[model samples]
Target: MTDVFFYHLQSRPLEAALPQLLEKCLERGWRCAVQSGAPERIEALDQLLWTYDEAAFLPHGTDRQPDPARQPILLTTAESNQNGAAVRFLIDGAAIPDPSAYTRVIHLFDGNDSEALERAREAWRAARAGGHEVAYWQQGADGRWVRR
Candidate 1:
């Protein structure tokens, strides 16, 4: 069963939260693929992962890489998991068609956006109905993820 996670972003933007989550996945020795609904979002995400921090370096690539398997992290608008990622992240209101294919699937949404919040709820219900373990996390006052 795929462990489904919903991250409600309130205190910080995607740029602040995404890297932290990706870092944790990397520490767990898991390859991750971040999928966005729009191509521009994918392109923006690729740049964010690289320049988000000065000291930190997240080795990632989009379709420009000669080999997808070699990338530790991948940012793409495609639904296909070309990197064989252990974890899949759906960002910017993106939805995964088949969640069970990955070890974990994360649905991240901006809490401030009503549409995003609605999408997260729908995703949670769908995953639960599918018999997958679901977890909900929201940002605390200090911008840390607190399970709710």
Candidate 2:
């Protein structure tokens, strides 16, 4: 069963939080695919991953790039797992793909946006209905994830 994680972004924006999570994924030797609802968001993420930290480099490429399957992290707007990623991150209200396609599926949403919140809820229900193991994490006062 796929482990589905719902991250409620309240204390910080996705830009601040995503790199850290992706870093953890890399540390675990997992390849990742980050899917966004908009192509513009994917473009933004492509830049963000490259320069999020001056000392750290998260090797990634977008679907538009050549040899997307060779990328450690592929940023895309499509639902297909082009990189053969073990983990898939759905951000910016991206539609959830089949849970079984990856080992883990992460859904991150803006807590401040009502529409985003509703979408997250729907995704949560869908994940549960699909019999995937679901977990919810919300940022605590210190900007740390506390599974809820």
Candidate 3:
């Protein structure tokens, strides 16, 4: 069974936590499949993948190598109606189809953006309905995201 780890937060990019998460997965001999199509997410992951590729941190096996064409961050959307994956990190109204396919879901929300807030709520509802483990992270006024 695939295990899902979610990092939901307010106002902070999920990419900030990705390096640490990927490192942890590598430590455990697990390769994570990031599912996102956001340009920012892709760009960040690309750097990490390169770091791993160049042996800056550690040697990366095929499992750790991110697919360039089909970035692990964004899965194929041919099967869904949503233009992008269902993620509410920086936007609103993104839907994740077949939540069961994901072992975990991370919901990040910023109290500042109404769209983000709506996406967060929707993600919570969808995750609950799909019986998936979802994590929430919210940004505090001090400018840090704490798991809520």
Candidate 4:
């Protein structure tokens, strides 16, 4: 069964948090695909992964780039898993695909956005109904994730 995790972003913006998650994925030797609801968000994330850290490198490429299948981390607005990723990250209210296709499915939503919260609720129900293992993590006051 796929393990589904919901990350409610409260203390930090997605830009500040995503790179760290992607780094952890890479550390686990998991190829990852980050799917966004809009092309503009994908474009923004593409640039973010490059300059988020001055010393650390998070190797990634957008789906528009050549050889997407070879990238460790792939960013896109599409549903297709071009990189054969072991984990998939859905952001910006992106639609959830079949969760069983990957080892893990992560949904990152803005806590401040009502629509995003509703979408996350819908996703939680869907994931539970689909028989996938589901967990919710909310940011604590200090900005660390606390599973709830």
List model 4 lDDT by residue over 55-112, tens digit each. 9999999999999999999998889989999999999888756999999999999999
Task: State the displacement of the C-alpha of residue 2, model 1, in Å, after optimal TM-score superposition.
Answer: 1.0
Q: Candidate 4, residue 62: CA error in Å?
A: 0.4
**Which one wins by lDDT: 3 or 4?**
4
Poorly placed runs, candidate 1 (over 4 Å): none
Question: Taking the tens digit of each residue's C-alpha lDDT, what string does model 3 give over 18-93?
Answer: 5455555446654334444454544555666556434436332222335423332332212242223222122223
lDDT comparison, 1 vs 4, better candidate: 4
lDDT of model 3 at position 129? 68
Residues 12-64 of candidate 2: C-alpha lDDT, one tens digit per residue: 99999999999999999999999997989998888888888999999999999
User: Cα lDDT of model 3 overall?
Assistant: 0.45
Q: Considering every candidate listed, which one attains the maximal TM-score? A: 4
Candidate 3: stretches off by over 4 Å: 1-6, 10-12, 39-41, 48-95, 108-111, 139-147
Q: What TM value does model 3 have?
A: 0.54
Q: Which prediction has more favorable lDDT, 1 or 2?
A: 2
